[model samples]
Target: MGQQSDGDAAVGSSTEFQIRQSFQNKEEVVLSVKDYSIRQGIEYRVLESDHLKYHRKCKEFDKGCSWLIRISLHARKGTWEVRRYNGPHTCLATSISSDHRQLDYYVICARIYSLVRADAAVTIKVLQEATEANYGFRPSYKKVWMEKQKAIAQIYENWEESYAELPRWMLGVQSTMAGTVTVLKTSPIHLGDQVDESTVYFHRLFWTFLPCIEAFRHCKPLVSIDDTHLYGKYGGTLLLAIVQDGNSNILPIAFALVERENAESWSFFLSNL
Candidate 1:
């Protein structure tokens, strides 16, 4: 029986399985199997799956391929252990496609979660190259882009959750650092034909750190304002207020997030600034 070393389970590492190998849980077993299938350019179909066991066979099992695996939970050991394995697929490659059936967005996201978390701005081309380098196959551009989005969403909270946490985050900042200024605006929540007065939705936010505000007193009198579009699950504009120091170093003093760069939004940000 083969066992994966700690390094073998790390990001960008190769995945392989052997009979009698144990996994922490069913999810781990499934992920390793999927990774192995994708790396070897093969497809598999689940033959049996349940809370206590998992079994899979090659997609070409009926076409003379004798590849299959079975894993079951070892109640005494509190682990999932592979019971049988016939791998290193004997079936011919079905096609020359760049994509594989087992290499879906979810798998890609899991594989690249750490990279995306470390740098959310990493480009899709970079992710594609990384995937190719790791698995010897490059997925479609759209697929890699979608996978990056999912990875980001997983690292950071989803849009709805993030919007809901804005007020709490602002309060946390203010509590931790006194004199911090934060202005959060919310609109009434509307459901179908009725308005839910008790509920509110995030509309806009403006904030300036106490340190930034104090630093401005020592900086040049001139302030530069600019707005940039946000590219995420929810579209918005980020407004920034910056000032130059005596040494010509630019310092950001205030920031705001609004629906768009309109007269009203600009007015709101400027008033807060």
Candidate 2:
């Protein structure tokens, strides 16, 4: 009875109960709060969300549940701050229902992507169990599978963006290792008028560092060349030149990206080599 009285006092004294938590963004705040709500068996829903602020209320709002939380972006701190929280849930919450968005693809990805990346072989069952343990909910296998694919796509998209900065990256490499780096890019010819000139496209890209070239020269007179298929969004072939040193260490010399494994592509790759 004493503990119940203290709890009632805590809930009644709103001025004394402060929730000054910070979040990186509104999405983070919502996701984090959802997890907290699930773990504590508190049912709530987003009453309002916008660029500037977010408002959430107890799921039993129609039952006169006054539990509410309000968060707003702090301009100076560049973070979302909890501005208000009317505590003490009025209704019982024993389980998380399917109506909850915590199991959504985006949310699941944000929650478990780092774990998935750290252990690529982690199975869907393991992820499902982890989610249940952490957030009091278990997602279906199909949802977990879809969320995993979404996470992998986001990772590869970041890697693809790195390729766009290759020109500047090669420049920096050349600056660091003077006369040791080489980069080449070729495009198709435009045959038509001004508007069609935009159709000209990049065909191939090749890069090599002089250190690898010189290292191979002293290692062995034998050279091994191979090509592999790239499984990125823009599918292509990766051609590589390598040599084995006296100690049997494989040293890579150069690499190139071509459209396909055809004779013309092979020739273009060999010419660069």
Candidate 1, poorest ten consecutive residues by summed lDDT: 1-10
Candidate 2: segments with Cα more than 4 A from true spot: 1-17, 20-28, 41-43, 64-66, 73-81, 88-90, 94-100, 112-133, 136-163, 188-195, 198-200
lDDT of the structure predicted as candidate 2: 0.69
Every model: Cα RMSD to truth: 3.8, 8.8
User: In candidate 2, how many Å is residue 189 off?
Assistant: 8.7
Give me candidate 1's TM-score against the actual structure: 0.90
lDDT of 2 by residue, 199-227 (tens): 44546778788788778778888879899
Which of the numbered candidates is closest to the native, going by highest TM-score? 1
| Model 1 Cα RMSD, 1 decimal | 3.8
lDDT of 1 by residue, 200-233 (tens): 8888999999899999999999999998999987
> Which pairs of residues have clashing backbones in candidate 1?
none
